[model samples]
Target: MESSLLTCKKKISKKCHVPRIGTSLSHFEPKKRLIVGTKPNIPDLNLELPSDSEEEEKDASDDVPKLLNELEVEIFARVSCFEYWKLQFLNKQFSQLLKSGEIFKVKRERELVKPYVLMLTSGNSRWTMVDKSFKNFRRLPEVPSDICFLYCDKETISAGTQLIVVGKEVESIVVWRYELELHKWTKGPSMITPRVMYGSASHGTDAFFAGGIKFVEKGIPKVCTEAEKYNANTKTWTMICEMHKRRKFCSGCFLRGKIYVIGGRYENGKNLTCGESYDEVKNSWTLIPNMLKDITFKSSQSPPLIAVVNDNLYLLETSSNELRVYDVNENAWKRQGVVPVKANEASGWGVAFKSIGDRLLVIGASPLPRSFIKRMAVYTCRPSPYVEEQVWEETENCYDGVELSNFIHNCCVMFA
Candidate 1:
């Protein structure tokens, strides 16, 4: 299975085109600083020169005129994070401020953060970061790992400003993180128990990973129940309590202030209908049996397609292309409506389903007639379980003319 996926990825990469970073503030000409007046040739002999300390103070105040440095940072924090890259070109101070990630910290404290979608499309080695509007996007630097890691099946999740990609190399499983502030990919800070096909979800600066397959002696695969938490701020992973049942190909989400892992097969190759919820304060997992009992299972289908928006858990039924909302109190799923995308195709493979802020975002091949040529379709809807039909709005011209494959290898949303 892994070898076949790697071969498919290799073929896709060959046909992909790496998009250049989009232009920002490029049209406007630089405003030349004006010289109001020339210095006088004759100096007053009695005039006392300013002290070194006084000169330094004056320069510091001039850094942000009429505002203290803290106030300047506060102002910048309120601005959309997508425009932050352009701010670096303003001056060295702005560049330093962005690189320091101080604005992001301020935005978090002030509750001014916004979600940006990061996607690794099929045939594209580099990841693309797109704003919530999907109007502006920039290509991220390619991961610096070897071809083995590059073409292998990978899982992506975002914690704070870090985008973490977990995959297998020739010798071992590797963790590669793309730091938004640094705008670079760095390796290490791997999971406590390195594994793949695990369920992962991010909350604030911390991300949780649980229940994946790990290789034992001589490449023998074994299902694992071990769970771990990754703190992006500290760049560290801490072991958490294991789940009741061992699982692989499970899906995870942060809902109702808890991390929920749902629907994956056990080591014995039997599908699991139960779900588990982890409580950080109690440091335990609560097993919820038949969490996915309503949904039909397929042997060759991808892991459960799920996302959370407004603390409501939603599942995309791949067999029917229908959307269902989980009722926490009732412990059952409520059918919303059919998704516009062709999720049923390929058994939910090559599709990106995620929550972007208040809206549920779905990217895949459109079921519409014009989708015959394989043009990727992007749609978003404000999902409400109370409503019978979901009104999905297609985000036209959002791809910036780049031909992206409908097959999304990995996708995650980073709120920074």
Candidate 2:
């Protein structure tokens, strides 16, 4: 019996023998191996583990509640203004932070302000506010006023966050302001000398209006040289030194830290080639004679189509549809290139030419074939005074299927 047991034990020991190092185990039946000090082979359960990003987000969500409100505002202030609308919808705290205008104040302190274009096209009583890319736009609330004021010829300019529209009512010339913060229109804070077709310009938080026609006792239009400075924060207008010459239908631009009024007619109905620049330091006007003498004038032309970019003045000559840059030292305009739009068709009536940041923006009816159905074209160019030819690129239309009239009645850029 002992010999038989010994023989069975020997057989079992041989069947369970450990394979030598570097030896093949192919002859053995396939089974998971278990080592003495290591974990046994186990099937994968496919469990999902939290990723680093998800863990970090969880940590931030947990930590946010501990931050103070002032610290929260400081954090939100660094966000882009384009995301503001979305942030306002996050919670009541964020909505109140934006509504209180504290974010904008912080942005101003950090020099993070952005520019928006406010334009009133023909056949449209409401104004359109668009971003620099023209990708996003919203129609402003309609001005609550008489039909005469809505349909009449109006002048628009922006200072700080206020868009001021000046138009003639049945009884008087009135000022209607669109406050961005309030998102509504309010009348009053009328100009000291209410006028139309004036040369207007904006700088920082102030807007300057000068040299337009005003109605007198008999409703007869009389040209004037009076100027006024409007403070957006104070919501008041104070009279400033008058221009050197009485100009009507003039165009104004802020250049080299001064307000320049260019290319308008005198009271005698004769076109004036001279321009004037207002120096805030001296509080006086410097006459720039023969500013427009080199360029030809049309029989009935609109005001000089001018814009300032990088402290340089540019003109869109409507007669020839030519883009010219002013030579400060020579007092002459050097032709840059021919514009794509037909500015001469209506003598620059329907075209919108203005500066947007470092680029010059032009919006008007395309010169494409009529079969194209007269689509409005939007083009922008980064112009350099030294470059002989400017290359203009078309921007994507984002009017949201609204067929806006190509005739832009009022357009202005506001940096807020």
Which number leads on TM-score? 1
lDDT of each: 0.85, 0.84
Can you write out model 1's per-residue Cα lDDT over 1-416, one digit (the tens) per residue? 33553465455444332222342233111111122345534657999997985454332213333244465577778887667778777668878878888889999999999999999989999999988888888999989999999898999999999999999988899999999888899998777899999899999999999999988899888999999999988999999999999999999999989999999999877889999999999999999999999998888878999999998999899999999999999999999888999888889888899999899999998787963738878999999879988999999747657877888999999998
Model 1: CA > 4 A from native: 1-67, 370-373
Off by over 4 Å in 2: 1-69, 75-90
- TM-score for model 2? 0.81
Candidate 2: residue 143 lDDT (0-100): 98
Could you say which candidate leads in lDDT?
1
Question: Model 2 — which ten-residue stretch has the worst lDDT?
Answer: 57-66
lDDT tens per residue, model 2, 281-364: 888999999999888887688999999999999999999999999998999999999988878889998789999999999988
| TM-score (all chains, Cα) for each model | 0.83, 0.81
